[model samples]
Target: MIAPLMKQAGRFSETTVDGEVVLLNLDDGAFFSLTGTAAEIWALIDGARNREAVIAELAARHNADHAAVAADLDPFLADLQARGFLAGA
Candidate 1:
């Protein structure tokens, strides 16, 4: 399965400023901004980490429970996929 944000890397222009991300969809001229935990998640999406890996790393970084992070993160990823910001498997 493709990492959710991998396939569409070419379709968006990503800019990071002060630990935040702004993604501009080239095809649609729509943009998305990421900050806080969202920015942290965006930084980990390197087209190599699977969903679990991403979650685990985030959990470790925050000394958080893996399941707890997943609870919030999975839905956010799904929303991004639905918005064409991510490529769902």
Candidate 2:
């Protein structure tokens, strides 16, 4: 099944802290601090990419196995979806 789009009403803002980016959810006052691989994956979640494309691109960029990346990404994506930071396109 395709992932659903992030809610339109949710507000997301990002800032760099000590050379790392942190994404914030203004509505609920939640924050996600991204670093290393998680940060890389988070950066790919524009509104234009599908799940498969994201997996492939991230795999190539990180020099990681596709299945492994997908495995790690599934829950992260789910959490972002749950938190309104990412929307499927």
Estimate TM-scores for all models: 0.85, 0.77
lDDT of each residue in 9-89, candidate 2, tens digit only: 457888877657798898788887888877766666665566787899989987989999889888988887777776542
Q: Where in model 1 is the C-alpha error above 4 Å?
A: 1-7
Q: Best-fitting candidate, measured by TM-score?
A: 1
- Cα-based lDDT for every prediction: 0.81, 0.74
* Local distance difference test, candidate 1: 0.81
Residue-wise C-alpha lDDT for candidate 1, range 58-85, written one tens digit per residue = 9999999999999988898887776677
Candidate 1 vs. true structure, TM-score: 0.85
